[model samples]
Target: MQKELNLCWNFGCFYSWSKTLGCNLTMQVQRLESGDFDLRNRQLQFSTFQIINVVRRESIEIGYWTAKQGIFRNLNQDVSAHTYLHPMPDLNPVVWPGQTHIVPKGWQIPTNGKKLQVGVRTSGYPEFMKVERDPVTNAITATGYALDVFEEAIKKLPYAVPYEYVSFDTLGVNYGSYNDFVYQVPLGVYDAAIGDITIRHNRTSYADFTLPYTESGIAMIVPVKDNTNKNTWIFLKPLTGDLWFASIAFLIYTGIVIWLLERRIRNAELTGSFFHQLGTAISFSFFADRERVDGILARLVVAVWVFVLLIITSSYTANLSSMLTVQKLQPTETDVHELLKRGEHVGNGGSSSYVRELLEQLGFERSKIRAYTNPDDFADALDKGSKNGGIAAAIHEVPYIKLFLAKHCKGYTMVGPIYKSEGFGFAFPKRSPLVDDFSRAILKITEADAIIQIEKKWIGDEHACKNDETIISPSSLNFKSFSGLFLVTGVASTSALLITLVMFLYKNKHKMGINIGHDHVQRGHGTELETERIQESTADSNILHRMIQMTTPASKR
Candidate 1:
């Protein structure tokens, strides 16, 4: 053994034999590895004496040396009392020169090796943290997605974090809000908190949050109503407003083109009274058997227009039939704007004022906002409606909403914009070393589908009502859906009009005294005007006269 001891002679030093050596030197000392023992700054507790000896072994075991419950003397011979107990295994380096001998940083050193005091939120948000007490033994059990995740993360940690859940909700104790519950961590009320606590900027100011484990959004939940009985305008409901207007306008345009192409032909059905002629012009397609078209251009326009009409009518019939047969379920309230404009009351899940503040910021009156503590309250408020002293809708975090929907899957649904948020995370004291370790553990579990298993255990039926077709309403057919059809029909009508005009002008070229040669491009406008006048005098001249007038020079008109 190397007996050369590096002792501070100025402060004085004393040596005593080990306990087995029968020296009676009752000192609180544990075997320490070979290292520089800085006794100058260390708060020494020397109730007994310890021999400084270095024995060479096959391998060197290096670790921290902590003193607990002992007495020491300085250069002035003044005795100062301190207790340095290494309650936990040290894996990192840190020097504590104060009253308490703490373990190294990044690791926990509980006094007397006590378990960690992890505060699980009580009574408020059960979707993340749920606590139940047994009546026989009064034992508290914490369970939920958050608790599962926390336990899984703890298992992944390098060191075992011995912890017991302490619920904030107790007899005669006002649990307060989530913010207040989180604040208790800094006050040493809890070593950490695990729940559906959102990672917001304000909360992070006093506490550190782990990475979010759930979707980050606040959504609105509203009841759905069936519209199968309300079918006064069901025919119009098959097509959107723009589509209806476009269909009517194109039908009229096609009718006018057909009339123009056949009017100058002097067909018996075309020559009639003002209203009779108008009926023939527009309703000729319906009277296909009775009416006859003398112009090939008019026949082409009729065929294409009939095809377009066939597709449109078939689509409208199918849509209307489906609407009549199926249940048209729609939300009682579609969005918050509608609720706010109607002066309807809205509810928020839980007792926290965070969602209330958000609603107020969105311009909802203070009196119009109500807070529901649980899913039952939410259901009751929604059932009552604002007019009957109930809320029109309730807003809550997506996870809670999902759980609520799972229970009340029949008549309710989540709707409107999802207000973005930082989702749910575990909270710890600001800059707590355990935060990093827990964060890394969380990453491990999330990466290996462990989180998914835990979520299925807690919120597996989140999308249980997704396949209920009664809650979804089919969308109406819009103009864009048939824009190509309109384009085809419009092009066909215009082409036919052009072709018929060419035919009429060619058939009467000699009577109009117009040449078809390239040199005829310089023909005077008087010639076209006289030709139109002679045609009008002979025939009714509805479309042919207008065609000549449009082709004539602007100055001549």
Candidate 2:
């Protein structure tokens, strides 16, 4: 009977354990409760009440259910009586050696012995049974079994499980001064994760970032004017000293050469004294006067030398003056405020930052600051003068102003210095995620040398000088023009040199009388023929006759 009771208790414990572990164990209990036993013309009802009572006493009591009172009582009494009559000695509760009662396989009971172990041999055993105690909190935690299983299961989850939550308050305390301070939020800060919150410029840093959002550099504010007509004097200032020195040297050299030539000519004419003049006049009177060849040659030589010197000096001075004039016209200033303070009306583009900085920071009156949409219109306004018909100063980027000045306006000049000194970049909305990505893309392009190549393709570096204050030389503009002039000059000089060389060679050949070519000479006639015949007869005579004729001296004859 005790053994039978133990079996019923084990069944009940397994049923309860399986239910807790998310397994179905109720069917087996129901079968046992409903099974009919036929014996000796007497019917006995097997009630589940006796089994449940035994389970509750030996194991942890989960809960109880009250059935129809008489049914369970009558069933329990019948089972007790039957067990007593059979008195099965082997039915005594078979407890493990150290345990007071048998526990279901694969389960662990606490050391207090208040509960029964169930499902001891099942796969859920060690996992569900393990427990750990926290030293800090003295809290008992289920460290093994289902807890471990849960951890492993979590690892296999498709998404990250948020194991921890961070709070910004833990990082630092908020100070009162930050309440009213103007915050400059980086456009990137709005998209970045700050403890899982996105913030704008004015938003609190609670789970929000304080990253710097602005790209900062130096900003110069200058007046907007027609900077195209750069003053020629400003450009020439640096080269004035050199030009002056060259001009002085040329004048002095030219004066000296002219004086020397004049003196030489005078002295040569004076060299022929009255006696020589009288002799020349008497000879001219007696016979057609021979041309004064020597005097004429000397005069021609002096005249050619003086003419060459004067031509060289005049050409040098003209070229030097042109160069100096060009050097004097470079753009020097683009500042608007300074121009306005000096009583000059300044013009600016309506949308340019130059206008804003001038009025706001520079304290210029709005009426004094004239804004224009079209640059040409602005230039016209400046040319016609302000509303009062007075000359207005225009300011703009050196390059743009220079181009305008070169093409359209000539009266206006760029004044003061350039205000801003940085390259322009495309502006975008702040806190955009695209900022970092685009910046990186720009960097990549720069690294690949694409930016320089693009610049060369469009606004070439040759035009970069337009942004500077230097005046562009006309020669630089029309390369072919300069080249053509140079070619013409070279050809003319070459022809002149070749002609002079030929003339010199002819003169030297005549003076030296060198026989350069072979030609036959004709014999003379008349008396010349008679003389030639006599000479020939004498030559034919004997050597003693010719010697006797040569020995007959004039004194002896």
Candidate 3:
């Protein structure tokens, strides 16, 4: 039986046994153990052999062991000689005869049959191994195999497998379980799951994760001021006191001057004692002086005063009208408590945090809150108010409010402090794979002081108002503030005009050549000269009468 079993063994069993025993078991067993077993068993057999005469019969069946030995011998010689042959008929009845099996000609399989053998020698079976090459590019195409096959292939290799063998679907399942799968999955079915196991979404039970490149916040949107209300009183309030004082002072001074001039002209006696007159007397005489001064000063004062008063009244009236109109026309509730109480119809910009604070977290009615595309629209609606039938209030950043007031010249005033302050940041989907990388880059930027540098590039520090604040020295202020300086300048100008008039009078005095105090003439160098001239004139009259008598002969002698 042992001999028969040994002879029945094929090349596979022979090779396996030889390898396991570390020697050729077939030769050793057949030579030593086979001979000893036969010799030891021959003496114990006692049986009679009977021969019966009968017709000679051809044997239909060959010994199973003998046929198996023939097949094994043929398979062994075929393998050793590298010759292709059909499978043994006796060994496997199902195998088809004369069927040719093809295998890689030049390659050899590993002795250990490891998939990734570095160096080995054996027949390379095509069913277990394959090599593919691109016909056009002549490049090795991807090798397709199972994970175990790949592991085995690299088992005897000098280095471990360089690539990770992960099933994206498996990973995806694990990740989905971990994160609760909040992420919108990309299109396509995965053979294996893939993802970082650490990420998870607690609230939604989703596996949404951020890429290393993702950031935490939205991009900073710069606040812009609409110029619709640019010239409004809200913007002018900073200088309101100065403008009001200047306007009122001008009107008062002009009115007073008109009153004083009228008073001076109307009362002739009062003009001489202008400084001594009673205030009441001066005031009463101003209008009464009209008749005495031919009504010129009175009419002029009345007209001037009327014009100035109109100007002052008109300016004040316009301001009051604007305030009242704005207050009445505003669609939103004007009072803060009213607005808070009527909290419906809140509007904010899309990216504003005020919306988050007021409408979302504060439990305000979100349906009533509308988000504006631009802050300008929000401000416009707010300024329009409930008169136009709009939202109650617009909550926005203080800086934006200031900017709007500055640019639009609108009269809308900021009524409250900053609701909250938040640092601006960039935002992305949490499932983005780039989150870590982006975070690292952000860290690096902070470490390198690049964030500060970038901030400086976009926005500088708050500017100082050098000209807005009074920087004048005390001496300069004193000079500018001196009331006497204006009075002196006026007096000096008046005195110069008076002096010019006096000089002009002196120059023109010769044209009339009159001295009021002098009579016709004194006609004297001395008393003697006067007596002589008188005697001479008397003698000349006597001589003139004789000459006239002598010459009168022609007509009237």
**Candidate 2 all-Cα RMSD:** 27.4
Ranking by TM-score: 1, 2, 3
Alpha-carbon runs more than 4 Å astray in model 3? 1-338, 347-357, 360-557
**Model 2, span 1-557: residue lDDT tens:** 11132222332232243333332222112233345553555845433433233322253222221232312223324442233222233233423213445443432222233221111111111222233445796544443222322333224333222221111122243321121111212222111221101123334432233222112222222223333424566433333454445434433433333233333335332236655543432332123212332233323433343444354446555544555554434333345445557655556655345334545566666666676644566656665765465235655444334334443434345553445422222122344443344345444554655544543432345444433434454321222323343344334434444554576678888866544332212223456788989998877787768788889998986
**lDDT of candidates 1 onward, in order:** 0.71, 0.37, 0.36
Task: Kindly list the per-residue Cα lDDT of model 1 for residues 1-557, writing each as its tens digit.
Answer: 11233321111222332222232222232333343343546654322333222212121122223244332322233224433232223322222212223422223334334688888766465666788878898777998788889888887787556688888776335767788888888888888988878788899999998888777788899988877846687789999999999999998898888888778776777776866776787786544542487677777777888888899899999988887888766787777887888898998965656778888999999999888888888999899888899999998878788778877888888884458887888899888878888888888887888977887777664555563756356678999999999999899999988887887788898656645554476566668888999987778666778789889998888
Full candidate order by lDDT, most accurate first:
1, 2, 3
Candidate 3 on 1-557: residue-level lDDT in tens?
A: 13222211222232223344222122212222333332344563222111111111211121121212222323224433332233444432211111212211211222232332111001011111223445696543222111222233234333222333222223334323312222323221211112112222232242223221111221111212222233455533322554455544544443344444445445553444445543433343224344433334344444444454454456556654454334221212334345446664556654443334455665666676666655467666665553465555666544334334444433344444434433221122435433343345444554555444432332222231111221211111122232343344334334444554575578679545654324234433466687899999999999999998887766665
Judged by TM-score relative to the true structure, which candidate is superior, 1 or 2? 1
Winner on lDDT (1 vs 3)? 1
Worst 10 residues of 1 by lDDT: 55-64
Q: What lDDT does candidate 3 reach at residue 132?
A: 46
Every model's TM-score:
0.68, 0.28, 0.23
Clashing pairs in 1: 45-70, 45-71, 46-70, 46-71, 47-70, 47-71, 67-84, 385-390
